[model samples]
Target chain A: MIAVMSGSFLQRGEPAIMDKFHRTKAALSSGVDIVLELPYIYAVQNSDLFAQGAVQTLHEIGVSSLCFGSESGDISRFTSSYNVLQQEQPAYQTVLQKNLNLGLSFPEASRHAYQQIGLATSEMDLTKPNNILGFSYVKAILDHNLSIKPLTITRIKSAYHDQAITGSIASATSIRKDLLSKGHISETAVDALPDVTIQQLHTYKKQAGIWHSWEDYFQLIHYRVMTMTKEELAAIHGVDEGLENRIKKTARSATSFYEWINKIKTKRYTWTRLQRIFAHILTSTAKADLQPFINAKTVPYVRLLGMTKTGQSYLNDRKKDMDVPLISTLAGTKNPLLSIEEKASHAYYSIIPGEKKQTLHHQELKPPIII
Target chain B: MIAVMSGSFLQRGEPAIMDKFHRTKAALSSGVDIVLELPYIYAVQNSDLFAQGAVQTLHEIGVSSLCFGSESGDISRFTSSYNVLQQEQPAYQTVLQKNLNLGLSFPEASRHAYQQIGLATSEMDLTKPNNILGFSYVKAILDHNLSIKPLTITRIKSAYHDQAITGSIASATSIRKDLLSKGHISETAVDALPDVTIQQLHTYKKQAGIWHSWEDYFQLIHYRVMTMTKEELAAIHGVDEGLENRIKKTARSATSFYEWINKIKTKRYTWTRLQRIFAHILTSTAKADLQPFINAKTVPYVRLLGMTKTGQSYLNDRKKDMDVPLISTLAGTKNPLLSIEEKASHAYYSIIPGEKKQTLHHQELKPPIII
Candidate 1:
């Protein structure tokens, strides 16, 4: 199943929310063999974007068998909305905007359009945003002519927005919220979480690293857009000609990243579409420069973050065939910026209270913890 | 005469000797009004190389004259050496190497080559390296069919290698030795120096802004070479195609920068030549890349380190048809790098130290003292 997941948005042009390499490693370690990197723009923008990037990467990768969790577990009802998005496609643009113009929030407008179309609203709980994202992923996979089959995982209580850690497996959202609020691995998350997840969180907190979120890159994003020449801005990953000048001029008046996006976003663009443009603009991410990288996915070297002897051997056996070199220690090298990202991740990981690393401002006391 | 002078050589693959922008400013501020930035590779290496860059830049810029200082005040002597270099140069190739193989120093080897040519022993005085450089510049201007003429300023008392400052304006060698000895500008230099010069040097020192020479970037240079693929290394600044693998093999064995150059030097290639190759590799300098710049002579950047109001007004009048932009202030702009460079130059100017600047480091410090 090509399970579409929202990759963490890296705003502020810092490192990703979790270590990107670390996150990829996490998914790889979890037996989820192929984790697609969701462009940060799609992750930060509203639901429409979640669909666009998730669907596009999936389409490009030729992924099939799309899967997601749904509040409405029943098979027939969910299909009705899915079918409406696929087959009986009324003008989604007109319907969605008409609802929004009537003072509905974007999510409400989407739901209202679904209900008015005689889609089986009774059987589908289109209220939660995550489910809507799940729905969009399904509809987009179908629309793109990809041969992906959709699968559903039924919900087991603890609402999508729930911050409480009730069971052994806590929601990622709650875990992240709790981790940030407590400023280290929370005892609740550490205690309730499965063993593998705990080690990942603990290693990242207190000593080795910090996390960056899209919410923080507001200034950097705004400034980058404002400064770039229109021609240069047009080269941004998602930006097109003429739109760049609009973005550049609008960027100056933007109060924040979101404000800039709002000013630049247009009828042809969804917020997610616009967010991707902003992300690219902020990072100077020219598609011409980076497209080759998209096709050429493997990094030249695999840096060892943390590994058991078994993991080490697993890597050693595979290293011979691997196209890239693997780097473990930086005892002799001259790269200065390399270690800083890991150190920051460790700082963020430490925020969950009562973990081995409970310290704040992690950079001050970073000494690599040797296994 | 419009004498063309090449600044420090930036040998590719090697660590940078001096920052080009800073050196250019220092030269210009020290009455070098029409500064030429001979690509770093050419400037750092020995005489033949110094000529290649300086001559090329002069030819391209359409400059008519070249001024180089010589201990042997007779300019014709340098011209004769120039003529000798362009001839079927045999004694220079072998005799020079024979001296080097005998463990003789740079001066001894240089003298050996000249003496073999039946030149007067005193005429071949190799202690004055600048004279050799001047000789090469003249040779190259003629060889390249460039319009530029060559001129010489007689050496003023202080010999190029003299450990002691024998005059008001000591040779850069003595100045550096004195700085190293005391870790600050010397009292002798302070009293003898022009006021404007002292002001900038003090600014640099106070700012804790390191005046990083070739030494500081040694690690960066090493890491850059080590990290690159064979093809990438070959494509680097100075590396020729086959030279890529040779460098890669050497990189695996060489421990230090000098060691690498020594390992690579051959009968055909001198240490200075190797140094330039290294510089090219590190800085991503290539003959093709540099050739265009050399042909362009100088970019139309006035790049004022510090200018009087009269200079500004004169520029204002001159700028109407000026091809380049007249940048006065960075103005919270993206071009802060250029401003940072200007501020950095404040450290190299050596007179009226306190008046020049109290510091020239972090953004917290004051900007360069605008004249």
Candidate 2:
């Protein structure tokens, strides 16, 4: 089938080491018939919203089935977990709000809320990061009454947050950490990845060096925080509950991104959550800017990032049946969604420093990959 | 008695070698009794608007006389030039529009229009850059019916655009060029500057190394141009006609800022004008954002950069007569003008790279230099 994945920036608020174009080529070389880009705004966000966007876009494109990697391969468990979250949402949310008010982070509060509600054991076992997202996908599918059936493949090795590679299947986190530490992917890591993927990664490294990290964006964020008033920052999404004051004050004394985050983070916010909020601030994504998309019943359009010959033919056959516009290239498109995508791409490329700028893909100018 | 100068960024859209705090101290040690900052928005504009902002700010602050260096120190020539630009306005504008339609740049068109009007021999002699700015200052005073008396001082040693360090008084352009090319200011160049200025520049160099040029901002500009529509670019103050199309077309293949500018520049727009427009684009200064400030009778406020005790007493004695606010620190100020300044400073610091970020001055957080 098709893979709808993050492009340019990942959920960690860092540039993808292998850019989307090459990544699509790698996917095409393998069994994937097509790969679609989840717009950067959704790509680099909290997993719940990230999963919702990806699944909704896929479902809108008329995909009949969906598959994802998770800690457990049991489809019934994830399905039941979604049912519990949907049916008991009132009780779940009440507990969630209580936990959140007690200064617990979203993930932590979610787990506590699920455990207190005595839903399925699977819902209580929200320890694996992928499992949490796996439930989100199923929930989105059910919530929208989509016909797409869901399946999960058990992750072979390595946890999502594991910083070290384990066996043949390593977490992308470990791979990124290794790439940063070693300044290049090692042969061992290459062996774990598909040949096409390795080749693409190597080519990108040679041309533009390693991609940038959140640290590259720290100065801009620090400057923005320092210059903005607490009220101004408070208006941004996820910057409520006086966190703006903490961010503004911390940004003044802390010299680096990690230091600033560490100073600003409390039990109320996880590092990832704080980073996602900071990413919004760094891009100036206010609540007003995101409210429409967040409240939309489904993603309004499908962006085709790449396609194989067979996939192109399939799309051609189904063109008239498709309800949403499938955007292959952003060149002259004036849709509201594309506008947000353009702004996000601008923010992504602006933070990358040095010769890497030459290799940066201007998302609007770049055409979809065809292999 | 008072010097109004550009802060952080200069007319060329490059960061100042010395930060504003140091520059103000240097001015105080030199002959200037008080130094006020020409806000970054006006500081980095073309000579006409740049002169207008600086002179208007000084006039609003109850300054009785305005003196500036020019190639021709003759006040009658400047006065006559202003009269031709003011009195024969409709004919001058007609000629200006005709010359502009012929694709000459604004400065070039203005020179041609003045010559066609045949007001004075001096009006036709628009060869010197300072003389052109001198004419603008005089015109602004006359147009506003300001009581500020105008005087001119003969420039010494070097021309404004001269790249060579000549005699004991070299152009600031030469000093900046040398600093960029040589990686450090040479002893010979140091001899040309006041001891206080040299000390300040040297201190900043030791702390933050050299400041950045517009090239440091090329990635951001390129991203903005690529993502924005021609209409959006046209909405920026200096971007007009089909120059937006030229910028967009040229930005596609050009690898660097200079290449982009060189490819986009035509007889209709000078490099300086293009740069000023690009600055506006980088700061997202749409026509709507500037219209309010432009329609105001004068700058709404005067910001003090630095002042000696004697200068403080001078301002203190005349404070009651000053029509506009005199802001020394932006700490808690909520004036509309400060909002623009804050945005400009945010844009300024966001482009600075690396360790220099630590040395970046938050304009609002900074107190005035009291020498």
Candidate 3:
């Protein structure tokens, strides 16, 4: 079966452990047929927009069903909540706005709004990270009226935010924590990851010499925030409600990335929300840069990152009917979204050393992987 | 006599060995009376502007004589060259423009223009750093018709660009290099500095925990250039003639600040010119921000960094007759130049640790130092 995943080259303002090339190779080796890059504009955002971009891209590529891992693995629960929330849109929005104005974060505000609208039931706990994202996926499909069906798989062994590698199946957060703490894949983390994934991780570490993390980017973020004027910071996407002042002030004394975030975090702005804002600042992604794509019917292009033999056959058969062009190389493309992607790629690799940086950066101009 | 040093708070895009407060205190202790800060807008600029700012500020402060160290050690040489250059302005401009168009750096082009105009006499070799600055100082006095008399002292023991500490009388460059290499005041460098200056350096290092250098700022500069769009960079002061593109490109793979500058440098862009451009980028000093002050008859305000008891008496007697306001505290000040200075101060202290950064930054708002 074809596997679709967000090519999170940069996630929440931090570079991923494995860049797109290595990640795409891992996916292809792990029984994934086709791998399409979820545009950066979506991948680095909050859950709802991220879900919308993934679902729309998958729908355009003629996927029959989308399966996601969730704490509440019942597909009916998500569908039922989506139906109720859709029917009570005005009431839900009003409660959402009221809670937001009362200084609740977006996730908390939306959860409160859902409960007020009688959409939060015992069968579906929206507070869990996976369940929240699962709800978003279902909501995106139903709201957009896409024909693709939604499915769910029960998340096993560890919770989404769990920081320990407990068993053979562990959360990505836990695995990354384990890897970063020891500067390599620990024995516990290795047990949780696939063999192919382990190989890819080793290769990336050997090539890049270090795993990418928020610490690698703290100085850059501090520099950007420190140098940017308040008006300039306000122009970046997700910098609202006079948050730029707090960011600038906190950045003045913050010695680490986590310390800065803890200082800036409030009930009105969750850690995740602040991370999204920082991501926008790091990439210089202004509101104007994202305005056109924010409400687009579908992403302008579907970037093909890699494919297996079977995946190649699937694309070969369906190429003529695909609604959007499949971008394999960035050489002559002129899309604004792609331009932002190119910039994001540069920023992602900017921390790498000289020869390795150029080699990895040149990957953006190369053709997609075919195995 | 009043001391009107260029402050060198940031010299050639690098922070000074001692911050302005310590430096001013050192000056006051070393027989200097009044200490006026050359405005940051001009202090961090090219030699011509730096000289103009200092000459005009000293003239405004009613200083009767300006003594500068020079390689030639002859005041008439500077005056004669200035006169000849002034009379041959049109021919010099033509040759300067032609050399600049042929990809010569500003200093090289101007030097060539001087030679073509017969102003590069054997009496004053314009190629010498001290001589160049001396010429600019004389030019500024003549160009503005300031009444302050210009004098020169022979530079002793070390040249302007000397990197090794050799004798008691050494260049500031050599002393700084020696101090930075050993992470403290070495005996060689100690010999070159006064007891008060050495004490101040020790205290600054103890309080700030580090000596500031271009290496300390390389990461921030690299980050700024990497994330900024070409247009945004082009808007910064000194980023001209498509240098933004080269800066952005070079920053992609540059491992260090010096390496990046080296790669971006050519016959057309000298190292010092590049440093000034980088200083502008670091401070976010836009051309528009400096446009009003560039050609003004005198600085809008003379900031007093520090003074001695005698200096206080002198200021008290002359305060009422001064043409420009003397700013001892930044509180309630609304000048654009002051705002830029405030931003620059923040950028300067941004690398220090938490409590120290706040303490050092607060110095910007405090009353001038008195010794």
Candidate 4:
């Protein structure tokens, strides 16, 4: 119930209506005892990092659950598969390697291998939706060994990647698309967005989604991959066995990741497994690094998004008995992940409530989310 | 196995490989027997229509077992849902009325009421990737009373609507994004598409996702909703109550279907449920019309996406006992859904092989899937 805020969520981007100060104030306005701000260290990174920062902030503050979304809202299936993944890593590895040997791309191989071991296809087709975010949450929770459970508030109809303006409740891509297409959300499309969230459409769309495409990023990623030596490739997030050479050689001819996968997929190798490998590389994730987080327990913190008046009172009463820190902000930047994420947050918001830079001032008054 | 080929399958949008000539030929090549061409009528429509058409075709030809995807991929969840939906009509009606009283849209009310009554909310989350397809299969199976057993292929990793391309297998949106950015797919992106599929990248990128953003066709849907009259709406695929009015009004403000849903959603309204309404309006389905089919008792035949030599032989040996039509194609049209679907199949291929305006006649050839 404790309301938490990621103050100054965007720099250069529009500032959140309730900066951490406003959000925290708003939370307190509900008559809650106190509001906490997440450290700037984690607030400004990519979504996964953001999720981690937000979740970690709350966990440290002592929260019991982390609600999120997934393509298939079937929690049991998600849990089953997740557990299976944890329990049968060796078998999965065997299948993964076999599929790769058959020339399958990592993603596809992973998907097919999962299916062979009993799972649903298309039902949670990661290739078409916001599955990465879903997985990121799962991975974060698993890696952190948090006691806070994960729940999801399933979203309505909309493909997460759709990059065209259709109606309201657009895919971030669509919102960004419309923003870029007209350099502003059409007057009509505004109703679909919360007043606080609209700048998301206005800013990212106006700057990044409009001016550049994933294609623009491709070459950079390719360069990153190409420049890597064998050791570096092996050190990348998902690199295993001889994949570094394959990626290096493939980088020479493959202009897009899509082309590279087609060259790799086979009967045994599914597209999803290969895609994961690429993701690991793009994010600089190393198996060695990830290995620790795979099954580790994530601690719980109450990083609040928004809370009602009644919710605040609940948090105040409960805070005394909590086992973890009720964190409002990071006291210092100790973790590299947190620091880097904090730095990156400002760059992404260059066009929103257009801040020139990100700041870490103590926030005591800001709130956009309610309940 | 008898292999049937319909000349119009290519026109319906299915890969020619799915056509009787191609499917059966593929089966034959794989060493199967007895490929019958599904009447052109039932072979071309969408899942709903295809279900009806396939059921009728099977009944006429005598077949058994229809396999499909279900989100939970568990019989208990699927069956439990079906039983509840089937038996709780009266309670659902009462809940629907009360929700509508609160100004909730029919779809919103229906879903909310269902959730209130302990129906699973995850099933109601429309943003789920393959949920609609799975639900449709369920509805079709129930309506047709066909003895087809549903089988699901396990999906791993990504959710259906995810936009961020991860692993090696990018979402179709990412593929289209890559295509849109490059005008033509780079070798990397091209490799992501099925090697045999055609491409119409610009069209896909412009719309968002293939077969996903059909808002342009809303005028037709809206017109049908507005002019159809209550009785007609009731008869339409998913219309119930006076939702017809809300749909018409929403259409006026709605720039897109997704927008329309926002205007119309309420505690009772569900997006998929709403989608079903539109689908019904377009297809002209009715509860009573579907009632008899839902009570059917046997599967018609197995629809093959592709098969290997062993797969073909398995079918060949089991054809007679299938107790349904083992069709592959049709020389002429028979069902409206199939016809519509047949015409629409080409849309999915709009971003792969870089083709434009695929012709029906050209859909006849068959090629190995090259697993």
Candidate 5:
């Protein structure tokens, strides 16, 4: 199976505990044929947009079945709920607006909207993180009219965001939380991850090389938020509609990233949404930089991270039919979006522990991994 | 006497050992009538521009005599040398061009130019730090034709930038170096400073509030230097003549400010000049913001950092004759220049140790000292 993964940063808008190379190695040893990077922007984005980017990329690469772990293990329920939301679009939007006006979070408002449109079900819980992403992927497939089929595998063990392990397959969220708190992988967490991944985590911990959280970037973010005018902050991609004023005001006294999040979190904006916005702010990502890609339905390139020999042969055979450039090396690349990803990667390296920091990680310096 | 001092960041282009409030208190207890701030732009600038700003502000505020510490302690020699360089401009220019062509630094070339034009004297040592500033102050007096007499006091005990303690009077540089290296003020260094200054230093050290150097800001600087293109860096003041290209190239490999300095230093730019340039870059000071004041040959305002009772009366008596606004408080101050100072102060607090950090030092929160 091909794996599309976040590189240096992850969906929680923090640096990955392990660097991309180690993560790719983990995937390779775990029997994945290929590993492609989900660009930083998409990787740190909210569930809906992130799903769209991943689904679109996978479809373009001629992947027929898109399978993901979901709590319900029922793909038909997700598709059915997505179809109902699509059929009653105006009614669903009206209810969503009502919920939002009452200061419910986006996910909360979305769930309320689904219920109002008679689309909520026991097997299709949109509030669950995996289910939310699963629904988004199926919706993107239908919206784009692609020929890709959707599938689901049952997620066993701890819930998506739970920090406590419940079974043999602990959630990735729990594993990361444990690793950060204890600074090493526990035996329980080791059981949840592949041996290759466990080994990498252990090595990074020994060297104090594991990245903790967005806390490492809190100082720069505080400086930016404290210094920028409301108008200047309003120019960032996710900042909008008086949110800049709130953030600017709260930033003066908030000493840490967690404090800023707590101070600025309103019922309308969820914790995850604020984290994503801060990721953009930390990188200084402007709205203009993301506009072209947002307007386009297809990703500009399939950036190869790592692949096995079988995967390489398959790519070579399908190279002639590829719709977009398959970028293996960054030399002479003309795409502006990819250039932003390169800049984001450099930003990622800037926060790693000093001894382990490879401060200059230009795209040209990294060759595609082959195993 | 009125003391025009640098604020949070100093002429050496790093955070002050203590905040402005305590520094003002130290100045007041040591017999200074008033302590006014040299706004951030001029405060962190090179000697020539810094002297110009201080002299112009003092002249506008009806100060009659400009007295400063100099190695030579001879005002007439400074005046005579400045006059000869001004009167024989073309001859000095030719010699200056020749020295520059021979790959000498600007200050060195200017000194050589003065000597070539028969302006050198044993009592007019322009190569010394205080002497250079002393000469600039006198030249500014002549250039503006202000009604102000120039006087000099001999700098005793320790030479500027000398880290070794030669006598009871330690240089400010030596005190700062010792404090950073040991994390406390030594009794020998204490003997060199006023009791009030010693108290402040001890308090800051007790709380771990001592700022080391540009090293504290090197990470943010590295991020900016790495991510910014040469064109983007070119917009900063003092970045010119393809220096951006060299800096951009050197930044890719240099992990620290000192490392970058070693790689990028050339014959034309001395280490101090480069430190000042990096100070400007760190604050994002653009050429456009400095052009108006440079072209006008006057500072925008005189900000009152602290004052004693006699100093207050002196300011009151000269209020009608003041050419620029003397700002006692920043609330409702419309000057763009003061805003920059405020931002620079916030940047200073960002690097201080967290527990001792006063992150929200607003203008309204800090009233002028009454001693």
Candidate 6:
């Protein structure tokens, strides 16, 4: 079966350890037959848009099912939650606004809204990170009236935000922390990651000379905010409510990326939301750039990052039915979304040292992996 | 008599070793009566504009004479060169265009134009940095029909671009290089600087924790160019002729500010010109921001950075005759040029560590120094 996943090309303004090529290769080596890159604009956004873009891309490519890991593994419960939210739309939105006006973060406000609408139950907890994402996926599928069925596997061994690696099946956060701190994948992290993932991590570290982290980009972001005027910062995507002034002021004294974020954070703005804003700033992604694609019925194109022999056959069988362009090589493609992806790719690899930087950057132009 | 010198507030994109307050104090202590800041937009620019802005500000404040150091110390030679250029305007323009089209930098092309028009003489070598600026000052005085007389002192002991400190009268470049490298005023640098200047330098380093250098800003400029699209960069002041593409491409592989400049340098673009462009980029000074002041007969205002007792009396006597405002404090001041200066000041002090950063940045709002 084809496997669709959100690649961490850049996750919340931080570059991922494994680049697109290596990650695709790892997935194909594992059991995944096909790998399609979720466009960067969607991949680096909040959960609702992220799920919508993924669901829409899958529907366009004629996928029949979508499976995700979540705290609530039962599929019917997610559907019930989605239905309850749909039935109580007015009340839900009103409660959401009230909680938000009371200075709650979006996630916290949404959870409050859900509880206020009586959707909280012992069998289903939507507060978990994976469950929240799964709920978004189910909502997107139902809202778009796509013919894809939702599936889930219970997440185990570690919590979604877990910072310490446990038995096996550790959260990505813990694994990244372990690998970055040790300068290589430690024994505990190796236990959690598949063999292919471990190999990819090793290869990426050796070739890139550094693992991508928030600190790697601290100087860049600080310069951006420090140099930008209030109006310019306001023009960036997700910089609202005079937040530009705060960012500009905090950037002057912030010694590190974490410190800057903490200084700017308040009860209303969550860390994740702030990270997304910073991601947009680093990418130079303006609000105008995302305006057209915010509610796009379908993504303009589906980029195939890699494919196995079986995945190639599946594409060959379904090529005619696909309506949108499937881009593999970026030599001359001109879609706006694809252009943003290319720019983001350049930014992602801009910090790599020596000749390896140019080599990795030029990877944007090469054809996708076929194994 | 009031002493006027170009403050190294930020010279060609590098932060001055001494900030405005300390430099003003140094000038006051070393027998200068008044220190008026040449607006940052003009200070960090090329020679013609720098001279124009300084001459204009001095004229606005009713200064009777402008004195500058030059290899060609005789002021009459500058006047003769200016006269020849004025008489041979058409021919000079043609030869300058031809040399530029033949891929020569502006300064080199202008020198060739001078020779081609038989304006270059053994008595006055326009190729020298001080002579070039002296010529510009003479031209500005004549062109604007201002009442200021131009004077010159023969520069000795060190060339304009000297990188080593020697003797009592060393170039500012050499002193900066020495101090930055040694992390203090070396005995050699001390000899070049006056006792007051040495005291200020030590105080600045003690409080600021580090001396400012181009390397300190390499990361910032690198990040700015890396994240900015070609279109966005082209909009910055002095980024033209598709140089944005070169800058964007070179930023990817460049490891430091000097390396990036060297990589992007061509025969047609001089090192100084590139530094000016980078200064503009770092300050986020757009081409549109400078359009209003480019050919204006007078600057909007003259900022008083500091004054001694005699200087304060001079200002009191001349204040009534002044047409434009003499701004002492930034509180509630509203002018475009002042706004740009404020923004640039923030960028200049952004790299200072800890509470010192905010303290220095807030100096922009503080009243001018009176000693």
lDDT, each prediction: 0.51, 0.76, 0.83, 0.48, 0.78, 0.82
Better of 2 and 4 by TM-score: 2
User: Which digits, one per residue and each the tens of the lDDT, describe model 1 over residues B226-267?
Assistant: 444465566655565387877766654454666767777765
Q: Over 4 Å off in model 4, which ranges? A: A1-66, A74-94, A121-154, A187-191, A199-295, A299-327, A330-333, A343-355, A358-371, B1-371
Model 6 lDDT tens row, A156-218? 878988989986878888888898888877789878889998888788877888888877777
Per-residue lDDT over A65-154 for candidate 4, one digit per residue giving the tens place of the 0 to 100 score:
766666777555556666767777788789878987887755566666766665546665433334545655666677668787877656
Q: Arrange candidates by DockQ, highest first: which order?
A: 5, 3, 6, 2, 1, 4
Estimate the Cα RMSD of every predicted model relative to the unseen true structure: 10.5, 3.8, 3.0, 28.8, 2.9, 3.4
Candidate with maximal DockQ: 5
Using TM-score as the measure, which candidate wins? 5
lDDT of 3 by residue, B1-371 (tens): 77765543554656676688888889899899888888778888778888888888888778888999999999988888877877899999999999989999888898898888876677778878889888889889888788889999999888998988879988888888888889978777778889999999888988998878877877567667766778889999999999998998777567778788999999988887788888888888898999998888888988888888888898888889889899998878888788788777767776676577777767877888888
Best by lDDT: 3
Report the lDDT tens digits of candidate 3 across residue range A216-286.
87767776777678899999999998999899878756878899999999998878778878878888889
Q: After superposition, how far is residue A56 of candidate 1 from its true place, in Å?
A: 12
Whole-model lDDT, candidate 2?
0.76
* Tens-digit lDDT string for candidate 2 (B220-317): 66766765656667887677777788887787677788888898877877777777777777766666666666646778788998888989999888
**lDDT of candidate 5 at residue A137, scale 0 to 100:** 85
Candidate 3: deviation at residue B283, Å?
Answer: 2.3
What lDDT is reached at residue B321 by model 2? 82
Local error of candidate 3 at A326, Å?
2.4
Candidate 4, residue B355: how far the Cα is off, in Å? 30
Candidate 1 runs further than 4 Å off: A1-14, A17-78, A89-129, A136-199, A205-236, A242-371, B1-66, B70-74, B89-122, B125-129, B140-198, B205-209, B213-237, B242-371
Q: What number of backbone clashes does candidate 3 have, counting pairs of residues 3 or more apart or in separate chains?
A: 0
lDDT of 2 by residue, A1-371 (tens): 88997876778666666667777888888989878889766777777788889988887677899999888778898877776677888999999999888888888888888787664365336557888888888888888888999998887767889887775788888877776778777876876677888788888666555555777666666656755556668987778888887887676567788888899888877788787788777666677667777757778788888888988988887667777888888788778767767656656666555446535655447777778
**Per-prediction DockQ, in order?**
0.03, 0.27, 0.42, 0.01, 0.44, 0.38
